[model samples]
Target: MFSDILCVILFCTLHFIASSSELQPGMPNVCADQEMSMLGARQPCVQAFTRMVKVWKQGCNSHRWCMGYERRTAYYTVYRQVYNMDTHTVYKCCPGWRQDGKEMGCLHRVCSANTCFNGGQCAETGDKICQCPLGFKGTQCQYDVNECERDEGGCEGFCCNTIGSFYCKCPEGSRLGPDGRVCHDVNECEELNGGCQQTCVDTPGSHHCECNEGFRMHSDGRTCIAVNSCSVLNGGCEHKCVDTGNNNYKCECRKNYQLKRDGRHCEYTRVHCSCRPGFTLAADGKNCEGIEMEIVNSCEKINGGCSHHCEHTTNGPLCSCNHGYQLALDRKTYSDECVSGGACCRHFCRNYPGGYECSCRAGHRLNPDGCGCDDVDECLAETSGCEHDCVNTLGTYECFCELGFRLDQDQHSCIYLLFRKVPQLLQYTAALHSRYVSDEDDSDGGDREVEIQRGRRGELRLSSSIVCLDGSFGDDCSVSCEDCDHGVCSENRDQCECAAGWTGIICNKTCSQGTYGPACNSLCRCQNGGSCDPVTGKCVCPPGVQGLLCEDGCPRGHFGMHCRRKCNCPNNGHCHRLYGGCLCSPGLYGRLCHLCEYQ
Candidate 1:
């Protein structure tokens, strides 16, 4: 019953939503419930997701894992016909961008975020181009230009510098000139009484407010209040108060060095500290003092730097090959063992990850030693679901029906096909069977089986021609293609699709000289003058490109190992894709292109 429900894509394959097809309607829903796919979802399993940087306990970079923090699961009421089964597809954050958690969108990249300062906007081209607003300059528009720095800002009064522009200010008794730079004298008493509560006094360039003898001027300088002693509000002190002249006082801490929060409270200055990546603190409570070296398991860091499997041991992560394959000396790669020695077995071999397993022909069983092929007597074992006689062969078995019946498509059960049987016809068919049947062509001349043809009147007739089963071909279908020893039989059933490094008529020969791939027909695709494995065509890129294919250039603003390092070049400088080096801009000589030539 659980099969009817589409898997939520529990922990992976969220990219399936991006690539689904219409599932054919009323096709009997032939897919098994297990086939519903956490591996392939019909739609977006996650409604929203976020990207995270520095994910803990994480160490792989492939298109197989969804690089996101999923916030919630999304359900669809309508069923979809399409499903994406490509195991390699997954949503991932582009270089220089990470998810907030593992949610829906790494939608934010370098330019997508607010990287610019002081009203600067980054270009969407992903080259880290920062477009600065007026009165600001620098790579990220971080520098505020001060307009008043030169020629006194061409103002008669004082000039005030602001973010984008500057303004002029006149003296207290003067009004700003129409030009906004000149100043004109004016009487302060004429306007708002100079902001005085009681009396106003006008000066040459400013004004003053006065209060009665019983009252004192407030901090605002425009209002007055009654004078009070330290008894009022405890002089707003949190520690010992020292009375000064005119009821004024200062607060002092006892054990601590300073006062906090408006000089009213006292506390010790707390130090919040932390250590770097590989170091821990000492037992003596020193600041990051203990320095110890630890060789972490490479597998834990990056799967032991192996392309296949990595096993952690007492010493370190040891790379190992998958079954049917052998590890190389470097321990990071593996080679197919079947082509080397596995093909010696009489039975065929099936391919799988890491290794291949030897499999016997349709009705044959492999001997204990694995090289010998023995026929399985389905008649003796009673395992064949045949409704009639079961005939055993050298490496397979065949099912036969009673005189009036015919073989079913299953090839095991008998179906009533003949409308009537004649005694003379039966005798003639019996004679023919006795003359031609002995085994899979072991009788006299490869004529072991007879062909059944349907006539225009819907009656079955025995023909002299012979047709082979699915895997068998040749004259009577009795001749199984024994040539494809450890490889797959080709579509035409004439040749074999040899493994990466193997070739030849029977796939018994290795790839010749510098050739690789199926039948040794393709060449390696290594770039930057790199080398490659002749058998697998696996490229070994030089110190430039970061892709396994040795493609030039890296993701935007990223370079170096795993393309994980970000470039800090300024003024549209190019960055090395594999080394994280910045190619400085013209006239800019320093590492980050910050130093000017004249300087």
Candidate 2:
């Protein structure tokens, strides 16, 4: 019996130990911190379920008991469930945003065409202007326009701009590229060899640098450094070594020196040389020449060694100097004239090698001697193209017209006035002395037509009486009147009684396109931006444009310039283009015409 009892005890102890080992939750099954995104786009993914341990009566611990009766404490395992929240804390980027490299936060994506400044606005979208006016973008308006993409913002070189303002930028040592969608060549060589130390070779698409003949490329590539020195190889030459092509060399002698028979060495060869009669050898013991020689038209050879021009003549090497220069003592070189006070031009003088030239300023002419400038008389020279009279001033000229005529758009010709009517008494002149015409108000209060002041320079004003019904003076109005050249002939043949918008020999022609007045002398005086009748000079104003020249906008209740067009708009609705219907702003729906768009 004792042995059996001991066996039972041992079995119970082993079973109990095994049960405890099985219940050991080592790492809680590795419940990793997990998360899920919420419905809100801007909301961050956050802890979904609580990260606390699950301990709701996970069954009482059978392995051990506290005081045999205390409510058995439950065993539990810890885990984490994440829910999306608090956008600032999220590790992932939201829609429309991306992680640029290892940047701490997501960066706004943009195109790489040009510099992207700070601006994005919905064109006509109401209210909901922008979440962040300067930086952030929310979807209220869709269409966008950046200046860089349009005409390159008028910059002949590369250009960039945001909706607000712009700042031009280029990498150092670079030039602004042409504007628009044009493919052009940027002369890299133009900007100081494009940052190259030596020769800069440019191609249609690229450029590069090259070293000189006896130079080797440096580590920096663009710069060039000389070779170790010809002493390295001696070149097997006695005097100097010259490199021609790859692996090729040649020997040369110094001035007044000659090479030996072996071609490897050089020796002095200076000695007296035989020359023609009247000639002597130079100090170098080489060349021989004479002080004077005779030759005809000898300019072809080396341009006669003249600094500027060589005159071909029977004489030998007839050398001459250019305009602003003078022949030097040697006659082969030239010297500046203005440096020694050769300038005598009245206005300004420019000097060169052999001579100097004088010129006049604008509105002035050079005198006959070519050394002085004088004010030109425009009237005497048929200049200014004046139809009536030319008045000469200090350095300019003015054009004036007769009393009945006005200056034409050409500023030189004179034409009849607009809407002229004959009065009971007339005061006028054939010729006046002043230089310019002054405009003064006429008798009518609303009239823009002007009348000139009385004669001041002892000019006469002829007062005429109405003898004949027509402007003609000879017997039966047979001859056409000079004053009625392009005006209508009234029943009595009165020139001033002619109707408006007539032209031609007898004022019978109608004014041509967009022109006004019988002689088409006056352009329409319509203020604002109104279009005028070519013949009658009547103004036609556009909708919402008011005043004589369409100067102001239409009022709320009406549309046309005269407030003729009326509309029925309610709930703070506004008129459409022609005011034919109503248009609402943001909130109101349809007041008659639902023309407003949401975004």
Candidate 3:
């Protein structure tokens, strides 16, 4: 029953649509060929044809009356043609009008009423009606189908409805596709990256902007800017912080400080203290003090806990013996039972506080090895009793006079010999003769020669000769001498005298050790194991040492020749004294001026 009802409802809806289509004035004819032929014959057609004609006439009457007098006359002319067709008169219809059958009923030709709207076509049926095109509805297609209400008009973005038509639209950053109903990404970035400051990316129906590494987008979402890593907390550095590229930073410390394990804080590298022995660190950890004081004080509080007196020293506490008591082998104990036999002392042994002292007799002194005694040399000491020469003995000294002199009542004084004046005169005469010989030798040798002699009265006498031979001197040409090394020979004197600094008669000896200069009278002052040049009096210093006396060491950045030569070392390097080449620092090589090995 329900199926029948549903079928009836469907058939009724279809019938309504068909009836509505026929209501238009341009509908096509619905009559069959037999009915059309019977209408054209002299006898009338079936009743159904008459009913259909009556309906057409009623529609025409109503349209004519409503359209005014002019349309009514035109309708009447068509009605008369139809009525006259019953009389079998052979007549023609007006232009754009035609007969439905061969002899009677009249109707409009195809689309004769011009009643269709929006490009709809008009056709002839029993009555004229409009045939609407796609996207249109109603008798004249005056209304538009609302495509937007049905699935968004097949548009990817927006839709708009219009009379007899509809169109699709797109939002910003989007465009309509070739289908004319769907939207696609506009690709605004295709032209100059969408005018973005860095990067641009396309999305569904829109476009967005981005930035590259080490940069961030601005508030406008299009511009980019570099990141500043040091702006916050100075990159967590305690002393100094430097910003590198790509938002990175490094930390550094001040002089005398080093970076801590955290890589942010600084720590002191040097502390203030005197590095003394028997000392320990103080509470502050930066100073030092003697620990012996504390130990001594503690020991003193316990009275040293020794069998003798306690003494405080820098080394702590010590046990001492009392008078008449000897320190035992244990050293910490004193014993009065031990008596001295004087065997340990070479002289008089006297007992003193804590130990025994040795005393020497007159003219003798005690040695540092307390058990021995040494003689005091009065001759070398300033307190000698003698005024002149003093001779040292085992335990005493004696005064004496030199040769040709005698001691007075005061044994320290001296007296000259009785014939001293005669000898003095002889010595003076000999000196005068030597001068005369030297003067004569300076003159060019002529045909004469001179000889010198001493008379009985201690006076000098000279003799001359007419001829003199080579290597011989004197008036008789009798004196002779051999050639002298490092010396000049005096032709007149026939003698060789050594030059300065040459002591031997033949000038064969050089200056002795520890002496230099003209006459070998100057003493060497060279120090620090330096050697003095015999001729120049200059000192030659050893390696790593320089200066006149070799007293100064080679300072940094300098070496050789009194430390006057500058070093060519680079990168905090040192140099060798013998060779001026550079010694590079750790991890560096190749003349010290090149790049590091790692680099």
Candidate 4:
């Protein structure tokens, strides 16, 4: 009986160990640190599952405990369930899945119930699609679309299509066919063992070109250079050419200088020169000087002899005869005295200092002084140039024009109308003395027609008696008294006078208070005393008088004129009165003997 108890105990113990080998209550299969799976506890359940290990019980209640026989039986049954759980679906206590002694299910089992579009398996996902093992797209199962068909060339140069990928077209310097669709550069320089003979240059398209010492450029394009110093090489010649840039050169000189047609020699100025008029040679290679005109002894000769007027000609002298005056029959000199009718005009005549003038008749005037003739205005009968409506001025007329008319070039008579309408010629008008005539055309016969004498322009002839009191001459007689440097011609007597301290018509006004005569041409003697005349200005004193105003003569013992003499007195003695000898008073001695006795 003991042996039987021993065998039963051993069996019970073995069953407990077996069940424990799998996931018993509160136990883990693989380490609790293992990654989770949809197969749940068949693999293992971690701590978050409170029933990580399943405990055997008499009934399927959380609080129920197993009986002695029931615990043993339950242990044995749970041990078998744990051992076959992964491959077997039939179970007793664990209704669904059994992992060791604990029962659970595959988390993916419920997901297999749904379908997806296009045969895609419908699997639970977070927010995005979760594909099944060999499925794609829809809930139940899927499509096997080729990804590469969607990507056309994918990029530029050449298309590179990979399994599910595509890459851009790449030419020579690139590499490809990697996990990502991209191309990387392959340095040909490194492959060719360090590139160019002279220098390595990188470029697009292709590389490997060459440049000489003075030039440099990229491999992919053409490159060239030149010496660039041709001008310096030819000694900067006038004109010539060599080669420079890209193979070209030139030689030339500065502007303004010419280059020989030969294209090498240079030249400055192009002109060949001579001299200018009146010029002489200069020391400098190019300049000259002017020569003066010469004057000679022979005078310019003229055709006529002396008459009323004479003018010097280039070769000699020419003579012009006035109206009334003429050259003698010999034609040597001018003469005014003539017979009843000479070369001169009629009634008016006179001989001048050098020539002669002709006087016109009572009702006329000589046009240009002694030149010709014109009528005088007598109508107004002497009331200041005329008295009433003037008749025609004769030969020396008052420039009288008839009613509504004026004199033409021949001032002798009058015309019924104006010679010309322009006023420009009016500038020649002078004094413009005028009068009225009868305007027969208009109703007014004698009171309306005006006549005028347009005398020489800028000239004024005052009455002979009206002279400039301040000593002025000429037409306006405008001369200043105080600064008149030419002295003056007295208005009262036409006398010549010098302003106060000066002399000469223009006064030549200067200071000469102590001098007198023509122009202070004489000295004064105020040292003695004597004033000068206010006009002719001479001193009024006797021959022997001398003083500031000539008030006194020489004192008692002095004589000779101007008090410039003295008596011959000895030793400073007193002289006798009125031509007497020295008095020699007291003990004084000498000629005038006025010395004191030796005391």
Q: Given candidate 1, what's the lDDT at residue 406?
A: 53
* RMSD, one per candidate, in order: 57.7, 39.2, 52.0, 51.0
Candidate 4 or 3, higher lDDT: 3
lDDT of 1 by residue, 20-102 (tens): 33222222222212223334345533244444354333444654444444344344454444555533333344444444543
For model 3, how does the per-residue alpha-carbon lDDT over 1-599 read when each residue is reduced to its tens digit?
99999999999998886655332323333232211122332433322211111122334554743322222211111111122222222234444445553423346554545667878787545454677788887756677788789888888788898876789888976778889977777776765455355568987667778876646664345545445545544554668988754344567899989986655567889856654437787888778777544233625566564555887666556777666666655556554321334335565665444556667888778877776666776765756666656655446666766555545444577656454122211111112231123332223332122222111111232222334444443222322344355666655555555555654434456777666655456677776445666555687764455688876655445656776554545422346555556655556777554568888
Each candidate structure's TM-score, on Cα atoms with residue i matched to residue i, is: 0.18, 0.18, 0.21, 0.18
lDDT of each: 0.56, 0.52, 0.55, 0.42
How much is 157 displaced in model 2, in angstroms?
A: 67
**Which should have the higher lDDT, number 1 or number 4?**
1
Model 2: CA > 4 A from native: 1-377, 384-487, 496-499, 503-525, 529-531, 540-549, 553-599
Residue 456, candidate 2: how far off, in angstroms? Answer: 6.8
Candidates 3 and 4 compared by TM-score, better number: 3
Cα lDDT for residue 468, model 2? 38
Off by over 4 Å in 1: 1-333, 342-344, 348-357, 408-410, 415-463, 466-599
Model 3 regions lying over 4 Å from their true place: 1-114, 126-128, 229-599
Model 2 quality (TM-score): 0.18
Write down the RMSD of candidate 1 (Cα, Å). 57.7
